[model samples]
Target: MPSLTNQDWKDLEDSIKAAALTLGYDEAVWDGNGVLEVEGKDWEELTEEQQKAAEILGMDEDDWDEDDEGLRYEDVDWNKLLPEVKDAAINFGYTEETWEGDGEIEVEDKDWDELTDSEKAAALVLGYTEDTWED
Candidate 1:
C-alpha cells in the first residue's frame, strides 16, 4: 500500500469520526493501530421506545449477533471477502491480487478521482467516502 501522509491520515480519521457520529455513536476513538473504537447502544441496550423506532425502520434482533458489542472499525482481509465484493474492491483500488497463491489479495493505492460511480458506491459500502469523486 502507498504511504499516507499525516494530512491524509487526519482527513481519513475525521471522515471516520463523522461517519461514526452519523451512525449514532457517542464517541469515536482511533486506537492508533488502524482500529476505530466507537461507543454506541446495542440492540439490547435500547429503551422500549428506541426498540420500537428501530423496528419501525425494519431493524430486528436478527439483524445483529447475540454477543454483539459496540461498533469497532478495523482493516479487512481482502482474501476473506466474497468474490463480488473482492472484485469491486480491486476495481476501486482498495485491493490487489498477489503474485503467489491462487490470487491472494492485499490493500493497494487508492485514487479517489479515478473511480467510476459503481466503484465509488462499492467503496462506500466498504466504508470509504462516497463524495471522494464528487466535484
Candidate 2:
C-alpha cells in the first residue's frame, strides 16, 4: 500500500471515530502515538440480568471495572461460558468465530505503525491498547 500522508491519517482516524460512535461507543480518540483509545458501556452499565449472566459466565466484579475499558463479547472464552451465556452472546451478534481461542484477540505479527487504519480501528474496538502492540 502507498504511504499515507498526515491528512490521510487524520481522515482515517476520523472515520474510525465515526464508526465507533455509530456503533454506540462512549468514547474514541487516537492518542497520536499509534494508539486508538476507545471506551464502551461498562458492565455496571448493563442491566441486572446482563450482570447476572456475566457472573454466571465466570466474570467477577473486578472484571467490570470501568478502567478495564469494558468487556469485549468477542474475547469471551466460549468453552468456559455457561451454555446460557454462550447463547446470550450469540444472540447478541457475537459469532462463534470470535471465541477467545478461535484466534488472536489482539493484532500480532505486524508493527503497530505498519497497521492499516481499519486494522487499528478494529483492534481498538476490541479493546487493544498501545501496550498490546509493543515489540
Candidate 3:
C-alpha cells in the first residue's frame, strides 16, 4: 500500500468536503486542511464513516482506475494557435449588401426611426420587448 503524503491527505480531505457540500450534506464541514466534522458527529469517527459512505455510493477506493487520475491544464499546449491565419480564413469571399430589392434601398442608407415596429424587432433579433425597448 502506498502511504499518503501530507499533501495527498490534504487533497483527500478537500475532496470529501466538496463532496459533502455538492451532495447536500449541509450539516458537515471540514477544516481547511481536510479533517471532517459532521453536524453532531465526531471528526475522528469520519475515517470509518467516509469508507461506509463511499461503499454505499458504490465507490471502491482501492480499485484505482483511470477516472481516479487526471492532468492539470498547466501541462497543455497553450500556443497551438496562430491568430493571423485564423482571421484571414474568416474574411474569405466576404460580400457587401447592395439591398438587391425591387422597392427598398440598402439598409445602411435607411433612417432607423423610419422603420416599423416589426423591423425594429427584427433588427434587435426579436429582443425588442416592452421592458427591453422602454428606453
| TM-score for candidate 1 | 0.31
Better of 1 and 2 by lDDT: 2
Candidate 3 wrongly placed segments (more than 4 Å): 1-46, 64-67, 72-135
lDDT of each: 0.42, 0.44, 0.32
lDDT of 1 by residue, 1-135 (tens): 112211233455554445433434323122112222221356676666555544543356665323323111223344445466556555645434341124543332436666668766666544456343231
Task: Give the C-alpha lDDT of model 2.
Answer: 0.44
Task: Tell me the deviation in Å of residue 42 in model 2.
Answer: 2.1
Better of 2 and 3 by lDDT: 2
The positional error of residue 129 in candidate 1, measured at the CA in angstroms, is 2.8
Candidate 3 local lDDT, 1-135, one digit each (tens): 122221222455555545545423432112111122332243333466554554443444543221212111111122321233222212321121211122423432445575465445443431222333333
Q: Compute the lDDT of residue 11 as modeled in candidate 1.
A: 55
- TM-score per prediction, in order, is 0.31, 0.31, 0.19
Q: After superposition, how far is residue 101 of candidate 3 from its true place, in Å?
A: 43
Sequence-dependent TM-score of model 2: 0.31
